[model samples]
Target: MTEPTRVLIVGGGYVGMYAALRLQRELRRHEARITLVDADSYMTYQPFLPEAAAGNVEPRHVVVSLRRVLDRCRILNGWVVGVDPVARTVDLRPHGGPGRVLEYDILILAPGSVSRTLPIPGLAECGIGFKNLEEAIHLRNHVLGQLDLADSTTDDATRARALTFVFVGAGFAGVEALAELEDMAHDACAYYPTIEPGQMRWILVEATDRILPEVGPEMGRWTLEQLRGRGVDVRIRTRLLSAVGGRVVLDDGTEYDTDTLVWTAGVRPHPLVRATGLPLDAAGRLKATAELTVEGARDVFTAGDCAAVPDLTRPGETCAPNAQNAVRQARTLADNVVATLRGGELRPYRHAYAGSVAGLGLHQGVAQIYGHKLHGMPAWFMHRTYHLSRVPTLNKKVRILIDWTLALLFRREIVSLGQLSDPRKEFERAARADREGRAEEPVLR
Candidate 1:
């Protein structure tokens, strides 16, 4: 009997999950066994994360259960520490333990990128990233909590710090997050008589000359204009020199004290790619051909932000790290994998960007689809139409539509559950009381 083709997929992200789903559908039964291992059990719909942060969307809705999605494939929740291409074995550290190895006949590396952080002073301790669901929830709570703090505080310095929001990087993530949260905060101020929208400072700092480089320069300028009109301080060609002592110092000699500093500068490919000893591009992305196969690795394939897929559509450019490329590459990569197994010809991936869409909170947005530029309600409609079509399952799509519909009739809930992050705080206090031999008693301060 011929040995079964064991396909090992690292990461259950956009590329891995979609590719595996397509493979399970396309491949014949008993021919190949798929094993998908990811650090997390659920796949996060990253596009909705800004809405999640702004409390416009539920945090749970943004993450699709991987076990439910990849029912046929073996799912292992573990961190992939290293890969041995020569031995066809993957090293995995299951949650919080020592490493173990799993052998495979074929390897599909879709280990997604992490938050690209800089060595700015105090950033490791003070800064928060907008990558995961936890961060989104924390951000929402943090923002709302700041309003509470500002409302209670009589000190002008404290109130100013609480209201000051600084976002580094004016890409899709940063811009959307800033815009959405600003809208949420502005709306929240209506409930607080002491809090004023004019007191809130929303600052965006971009290192590049233009924001939203994925969108055309014209759209980028328009976005800047919209943000400026909303009273957002847009700083271009500026670098965050230091965030030390919660004091944001720009390279241009401007300094400001802020309680919240959001870092969405960008993302780099997963560092695990380097351990494979595979050839990498200048940016350290796994060097992959237009067909999504890793160079010189016959049984290995890679795609998404982690892989430097050659862009056949653009003569000399590698595919940009965006959801558009990731999802499209997954489809092509799946086809390629199926072709490799079933003795069919593989096709090269070549697709021009469809265009870009961005929401400036609620009914305000900007979009450029198929060469047609749209702004205001048209852009907002396109933004909803495009993302609504792409947000995975029908159930989720309907739920999101319902949420939007309800939002039109009802007001957005700005309440924060800050205790979610510290549920054990009360328990810790009780434990401390027990240790001190002080029975739980109500004391009037």
Candidate 2:
């Protein structure tokens, strides 16, 4: 009996998860062995992150557990350190364990991107990214905690500082996060007699001239107007000079002190791609043909945000890094992988640009679809409808829909669980006191 070929997939994101799921159905159990490796065991639905932060959707429902969905495939929870295409081997660094190398007959590279950041002083220490589920949850808690601090404080300066929220970059992530959080905080302010919506300051700073460039210029202009009308400080063509000491200083000579800073400038390809010895484009993404096969690398397939797949529909431009493209590309990449394995002809991937949608806040959104522009409730509905269709799995889709249904009938929950960030702080402190042979009294503020 001959051993079945092994198919190894790195990164449990949309591309990796979808590709593996498709391959499992195409290849019989005895035909091949499939495996997926990722730092986390779940794939985050990034499009719904803003809603999660706003408490419209539960954070747990925003992630699809790879283990639960990819039952037949081996799920290895770890970081991929390196890959050698020539040797057909990958080096994986597991958490708190020695590294090990695994050999595979075919490899699928889909390690998604990380938050692209700039070298502004104090950013590394204070700035928070909005890419993952943890960050979304933390940002929700941090924002609500700030409201509590402001309400409890009598000092004008302290209250003002706590009420000021600054978001850098005006792309979908930055804009939607800022919008949803602002909306949630504003609604919660009704409960605090001392805090008012007018007291809070929401500032959006963009280096580019406009925000939401995914939408057309006309819709972008409309979005700018809508945001400014809501008392948001929309600053365009401005650069963040320094965030040192919580004092945000911009290149335009505007400086202010704020506790919250969200950096969502953009994203580059995963740095792991560079270490893989794979052919990379100028932007450091894996270079691949339209068929999703890595250029000059044998038996290697690539897709998603990590690969620079030429856009056949738009001539010179590569496919934009979004959930729509990632999910679609995965199916094509998966079919091509199976084709390669079975000695069948591979299919080239090509899809037309499907337009963009963004949720500004609850019941507020903007969308540009196939040259038609929509705003307000219609656009918001379109945003939800589109994402609900793409979020993966019938169970998750139903869960999210139920969440939306419940949200319509009840007020948004405003509770903040700030202690999640340091769940063991109290235990560690008590243990330290025991070691000192003293009974520590609970410290009262």
Candidate 3:
């Protein structure tokens, strides 16, 4: 080998970031040249997103900067438009420049997943997802803004519409998000003298018979009961027929005039997986073996939610597509990548299914860990403890801890900064007025 091996990684999420971090830590500087390309420069710690939305933690602390952590590896903020294993090149369209074919001696494809959406009426325009940091922050603002809208409105219909919140999917994402945000909004009602907590309607619709299926049926039932007690209408075995113009129609013939509809149904593997021309399983994910190497190509590796990695612990089943599995898979994939480069034996990735834990509002939660069940404040503490240790970087962990500490001493801020999304709108209006000779001061606030 006259030249260093060019290792190109596509994605900036769990797998890509972890693999690059591990490779740079384990491999010699000259042995491999690592380049990671992703649309974003940071990796979001998704598990903390629910708390961020609920105002339990600051939104900025939920993401880790790739450049700051992976200092040894080269970072390119771009998109992997296409991948070709036979040609050993990836077609990349960088954020600020022209497209180019990048040659690589080895490839690590882990672009992660996107929200798996269904074709429903008005969904495209009305539904919002709880997938990324931006969505979490926006949802927080939107929810609080709804309260503000309802409080200031004299019209009964408009107030009712503003207070109705609908969430589809009862999985971890949907359940946790609803629980936390509902808790926050409940506390926020104290500030609005005109609004009562009961006036805010919270609804959860699931296509299946249970919520949090990962924790088994018994725990799922417990979670359902807990949510119902809190006035969250959990509609199990129900489907969202349509959300056209914010008129949510359920399969059970129930209807709601909600202004907020959160769609957290599920996710599909990144589309980049199909463009690779590599072998994929029935679910359209890259086919990977127990060793985290893509099948039929020894030089290619894959993991995370985008790869169909065989679960060695359970025969005939693949690893669950969740952050719990993705984070662990990344470690093994990183080790295997180093082994491949060093001509060493690659270890297989295997782990028994540990039970799951979920938070419900502030001091409430449910957990089934290693066959032990816990609920209420204990479960909530466990939820925070587990995630705090897992969230990337000490800086983020510390910042999150401080946020929680401050919450103990003070009430959570419910003020909506909706204008943050369009800070220039007021400025633009003012500039136009000045140009028109109105001679009026612009409202920059």
Highest-TM-score candidate: 2
Question: Which of the two candidates, 1 or 3, achieves a greater lDDT against the reference?
Answer: 3
Q: TM-scores, in order shown?
A: 0.97, 0.97, 0.96
lDDT of 1 by residue, 303-377 (tens): 999999988877889998888889999999999988888888889999988999988887888888888888788
Residue 147 displacement in candidate 1 (angstroms) = 0.2
Against the true structure, candidate 3 reaches a TM-score of: 0.96
Q: Give the Cα lDDT of each candidate.
A: 0.89, 0.92, 0.91
How displaced is residue 141 in candidate 2, in Å? 0.4
Give the best candidate by lDDT. Answer: 2
* Model 3 global lDDT (CA atoms, 0 to 1): 0.91
Candidate number with the higher TM-score (1 or 2): 2
Give candidate 1 regions above 4 Å deviation: 438-445
